[model samples]
Target: MSQLGTLEDLPIGFRQGLTATNLVPLWPNLRGALPHGIPTRRTRPLLWRYSEIRPQLMEAGRLTPIEKAERRVLVLANPGLGLENMQATPSIYIGMQLILPGETAPNHKHSPSAVRFVVEGAGGFTVVEGERCPMEPGDLILTPSGLWHEHGHTGSEPVVWMDALDLPLVFALEASYCTEGEPQNIRNEPDASQTRYRRSGLVPWSGWMRPPTNYPLVRFPWRDVKAALADLASVTPRGEAVRLAYVNPETGRECLPILGFSAVQLRPGESLALPRHSASAVMNIVDGAGVAEIDGVQLQFEQFDTIAVPTHARVRIENSSSTKPAHLFVVDDAPMQRKLGFYEILANEALPPI
Candidate 1:
């Protein structure tokens, strides 16, 4: 390939004239726009330890009341992407939110889809479109786009949950905004997680006759997911990764449009290398300790610690314990990449489907 001309190589007079007309040449910038191999990425492989964040999060609860700070949170920003951007990856935004006892986060809805993974404490609940879903450690609750959701704590202690959203993507498109409203009048019936979609491959009889709802199940109990992972691990081969994707029970598609979520389990003393993918991802260690090597950067993670992986990066995770399995909750932008027709996975050899 021929070397491209630099912008500075152009005559100053011509460059100034082009700038005055609000136009610039593309020849000098082609390589930067479309790199030879990998696409440019601003995300970095970094881990946030819960041990370090918990104290500051608790201090935030003490310093700010619910009224003053609606949904108090500390964003897990990637320094490579600029801290002011408030992004964990290019398309994903993650934060640790806190709610003290007797406090309530006001009802509001935004354009970006979001999910809450309960981290610590109990008796916390989120009301999504009038269905109150209780929050427990490891539970995954969906607050999809345009859904009115509010959080409250009834327990004696504080509750914290990890908030993952497609805010960066939506905001980049200039379509991100939230509307505050009055508290929802929670319905008397139980959430769909308990009634309509109770188990895998089983839905309400009525669902068979009608069209599938966009989000039939909003809350996935961690207890159920953990059990499912355990059952999957029993049959999974030693070299394969035990993973399960979260999907809409009725349609069996990803639960959200922009982001995808999954639960992964690493067998005791197992070190598994993941296929490199075009999408970026964030993994929150749900249980046990592990070491994750993202594009050659090794990060030590424990329960509740969060790690970020950039696009098209190599990743390997190892269970540090010899007697216990390690579980992780992962959030990724693969769905968005697939929608845009660029999702790809590179594997050296044939492997079991995840």
Candidate 2:
């Protein structure tokens, strides 16, 4: 456990030694007061909780290190990695969570970049790099690492989303870095800039220049995904579904390296075997029930369900219900892996007819 210190003169904090968190005092300040302190000493501070962050939902307040441990942090990326390694590779880190109406999370930032893809609810938003983007249930807001950001709800409804970041990979490589700014909601002052930058990128026209903004884009409004599906209905299998992926319309590449996002709708009792190879993925059940056979794990899932499959593991998604369609979001690290030339897909063996 390395210590949490100033950006430069690293303080021996958590992993190393922690007389106390550096949230307030610099190392010299504590050293100057304690002659009893020896060089490179080790001391245990208060331990915090890191269980499933499900209990703190619907509540927002400033809690001490001990109390803050209880709050839910929807980390989407790998659980533990540092920034140094994550820089060489690509991944997201965040927990998918839904905040109740009127609740607000304070300001914070880190060395690994982050984006919030709202999974449910509406009316809450995230303020990033000096701009506030209305958290409209499905908008994708971002906070590039090193930028200040906060989340709050001024509207009457709750806000929910998948908190995606590269922290796990970062923290794993021990390149973990963090810097929290002044809390935003304690004052409740509205900033007009938040809404302006929520969407500052260019619409991909010819796979050319993508407009510049904090994050390139936020592809949501599931209705739009549905519309695209309808148009492909005649061409797509009625028993199965369609998944065209969210791409950099202009570049025709990927939104980012290591994270590929897409959604689909499966017809009632429809079963389709999707060939699989390199991309490791997680699927979230949004609207219906289904069975996902991934690497031998036949998982039956309903709404609010989550399932993860390893890369190159044989996989297939099937809709087991006969009454309704199943809608879900499938995320992976494929497109980027393709750019690295390490992408692969293993087709199911063709069986000889009996």
Candidate 3:
């Protein structure tokens, strides 16, 4: 590569004239804008242990009530991305939200899409667009953009869930905002997950003639996912990573527009090295314990722990138990990267595309 002329190389008078005219030279910062190979990334590989977060979150619940704090959340901010920004990655925002017994997180909706993965507790539920989805541990519920959603806990214990949203991207675009409204009267009907899209290959009989909806199913039960993973693992050869993508049943695409969600299962005593992809990702441990080696850092994680991986980083995950399989809930910005036409995966071995 050739050296580019810097602003300092220009005469002081010319630099002053350009500054006065509100114009700046591009050559000096061209490489910074378009790097030689990989694009610049600020996301760092980090781990947020549930053991460490739970205490602070519980303290937050004790300190703030539902009326005072609209959504009782403790953001899992990435130090590399600046904690004040409340971002896990450039495009993804993650936080641990809590709801106590007899409390309701009022009705509201926003521009950025969000998903809630239940970490613990039961008898908690989210009503999204009139559909009431029960919150059992490990269930994944969606609160898509422009939809009305709210949370409530009917159980005795404290209910906690991981909230993942595309807030950073929407906020950066200046389109991030929410509107509070009166609580919704949930429809007297079962959610799509229970009634319409129960099976993987089958849809409602009417769906064949009716126009497909973007989100036909918003709730994914962990029981179903775990069973599916078990079935997949039965046939999956050893040394292969068993993973399944969460997609829209009708369109067979990523359920959300920006982030991609998936469930990965690592067999007992398995150490899987994932391909270095151009999308940043976060992995939430759903079951069992494991040690994740990101780039050169090793992070030991247990159930409910979350691990963040930066773009283009080598990641190797090992199941710590020799008798039980480890399950992970993964969130990635691959859909957005692919839409922007820059998603890539690099590895020495031939691996399937993400």
Candidate 4:
């Protein structure tokens, strides 16, 4: 009766929800849509320890040269996401990439925008659309989708960096494309000339090269970023934490089109509560120790640890040390979410709209 309101109305032989039933069998099928069942995320909270993987990464370097692997990366795969090549989250893909001395990764361009957060080394550079942007530890580099890019390291030591891409979002929308190209012999060896621009307070612009919607500056140097952070550190008002968003000088928005970057610092004994929103974030522990509690799980993270926070989960962060401050660099899909108008703060007071 009443259009088969419950799944029990079906035959006993077909009790499983996936099976077809006599009167549509709605109850079991509709249980996933119940108020308590919010399915915005498929990935669980994961902590990727750098210590466990660094040795393997070093081994990978000896095994495969840049010519063989093109890009030697150790992808961060979430256990909850069962796909073999699944993204860490539904909207982001993160990996630690390595480039050995005198090695160059083959040139390739893809439709999925990508960014790199340097973790170690120097004399490494990524050539994006003819401009050679040097990579240094703590520097952020943008290689927007559809740009011809390649990475090479001339330094004596190996260079490693975290590669963050909007591959999940691109492939999900069925708009993914990639093509390999010949490597460009672009180099500005020894010293990075780009750093000089910051001291002169002059913006570098090439009239011949330009891209639509991409940030004009490919590299955001750590030297300038640290200076800004230091300037704001003392003035940070009480009850407020220090956080700085990486802004595109051209548009004054997030640097990347899909991925957003922010530096968050919590003073000693500082605690900050973050409201739940419909975007996922991967936080790279920059320095110090802290605890980040998402939903109900408490994740203790130290330097170089990466923690993933899924959408629609309430989060609270605390600097566990009484004398040391905690710093984190966060990457998320907030830029894309804001663009699609799907971003919302779903605090405890209001339920997320279905």
**Candidate order (lDDT):** 1, 3, 4, 2
lDDT of 2 at 55: 40
Candidate 3 ranges beyond 4 A from true positions: 348-354
Q: Tens digits of per-residue lDDT for model 1 on 8-117?
A: 99999999999999998999999889988899887899999999999999999889988999989999999999999999999999999999999999999999999999
Predicted model with the maximum TM-score: 1
- Residue-wise C-alpha lDDT for candidate 2, range 257-286, written one tens digit per residue: 556677777777777666666665666666
Clashes by residue pair, model 3: none
Stretches of candidate 4 off by over 4 Å are: 1-40, 185-213, 348-354
Over 4 Å off, model 1: 348-354
> In model 1, what is the error at residue 216, expressed in angstroms?
0.8
List of clashing residue pairs for candidate 4: none
C-alpha RMSD for every candidate = 2.3, 13.8, 2.3, 5.3
> For candidate 2, which ten residues in a row score worst on lDDT?
41-50
C-alpha lDDT values of all predictions: 0.93, 0.55, 0.92, 0.78
lDDT of 4 by residue, 207-284 (tens): 224553455677887767766766777799845658888876645678777889988877887777765778899988
Q: Predict model 4's lDDT versus the native.
A: 0.78
lDDT of 1: 0.93
> Each prediction's TM-score against the native?
0.97, 0.64, 0.97, 0.83
Over 4 Å off, model 2: 1-71, 74-94, 137-147, 182-214, 238-241, 350-354
Sort all candidates by TM-score, best to worst. 1, 3, 4, 2
